[model samples]
Target: MKGGPVLILGATSGMAREIARSFAACGHPIQLAARNVARLEDDRADLETRHGVAVTLHEFDALDLASHKGFVEGLPALPDIAVCAVGAMGTQEENAANPEKGAMVMRANFEGPASILGHLANAMEARGSGTLVGISSVAGDRGRASNYVYGSAKAGFTAFLSGLRNRLAKTGVHVLTVKPGFVATAMTEGMDLPEKLTADPKEVGHAIRIAVQSQKNVIYIRPVWRLIMAIIKAIPEPIFKKTEI
Candidate 1:
């Protein structure tokens, strides 16, 4: 393998799975992590056979913050690059009816990703080299009632990655904040997202891999999102709040 061991959180999901495949194609060992380890057997086998690289599966649950420390320590080898693809987009209406759903959305999207990446930050800092990739969302550019639960969590995650990158800049470690506006994945299956602004999971994989290799601080999966979010963020709150997404 060329690249060092690369750990991918939420590996069984849409974007994360594609990312694992992309790195594996480049002869990088894959450490696929998610809640249902058994479901990843197919992906693991495919990566191993197709790319002729090692594929290791680790059971990971983003909600279980207590296990994050042990999870890193237990890795067979320290990862040279880590990607946090863990996120959940819950229904705002259902979330309003069930506040716990909002809490889960926050924890799954931000708290857990931050917890694991925080641990990696400390380790990578001590080691003095590593790439941290956090997949945030464009929804975070501003809170829209349409998806504020998801947006707010992504906002926190984006801020966290920014701080981590700043702190680790002096060191060899690089942290990247990835804000993907809209993507066609299981998470967004029900939502009718616009075509131009939305990207595919494979596209997300490409952006993340490139960002990690180049050590960019921030990236929009599709360049169009930069312009879209720029306009969204530029709008006045009073006017924005009245306009629906």
Candidate 2:
């Protein structure tokens, strides 16, 4: 393997799984971590068999705030690249009706992912080199009525990655913020997404792999999202609030 093992948090997710495969194909050792460790055993074996690289599985529950530190400490070895593809998007109506649900979405998208990355950042800083990839969303660029709860959380994560990238710029550790426009994942299974704007998991995986290799500070999975979000963000708040997305 060229680089140290590539650690993928929330490995069982569609996007993360594709990313794992992409890295494995490039001869990077793979460490897949998620709550469903058992379910990922077959995937681990497949990656090893297909890519001729080592693949290990670890149990990780993003919501378990207290375990974040131990999870990093328990890794077999520090990874050269770590990708945080951990997130949850609950229905906006449901989240608005339940404060707990809103909090859970917020924690899943921001707090939990941020906590683990924080620990990883410190470790990478100490080692003086590594890459951190955070899978934020284009939804973060603006708050819309359809999914403001999720959007707000992503906004926080985007900002967090930005700050981390700034701090680590001089420390040798690179931080990449990835904003995917619309991805067809289990999380958005039934949603009607625009075909032109939506990207598949594998496409996203490839984009991220390229970004990491090129050390891109920020990326929109489909380049058009940069323009789309730019237009959305430019709308005046007074006019924006009156329309539904």
Best by TM-score: 2
The regions of model 1 sitting more than 4 angstroms off are none
- Candidate 1 global TM-score: 0.97
lDDT of 1 by residue, 127-195 (tens): 999999999989888999888988899999999999998999999999999998788999889888888
- Candidate lDDT scores, in order, read 0.90, 0.94
TM-score of each: 0.97, 0.98
Candidate 2 lDDT, 90-175, residue by residue in tens: 89999999989999999999999999999999999999999999999988999898998999999999999999999999999999
RMSD of 1: 1.0
Model 1, residue 19: C-alpha shift (Å): 0.5
Q: C-alpha displacement of 97 in model 2, angstroms? A: 0.9
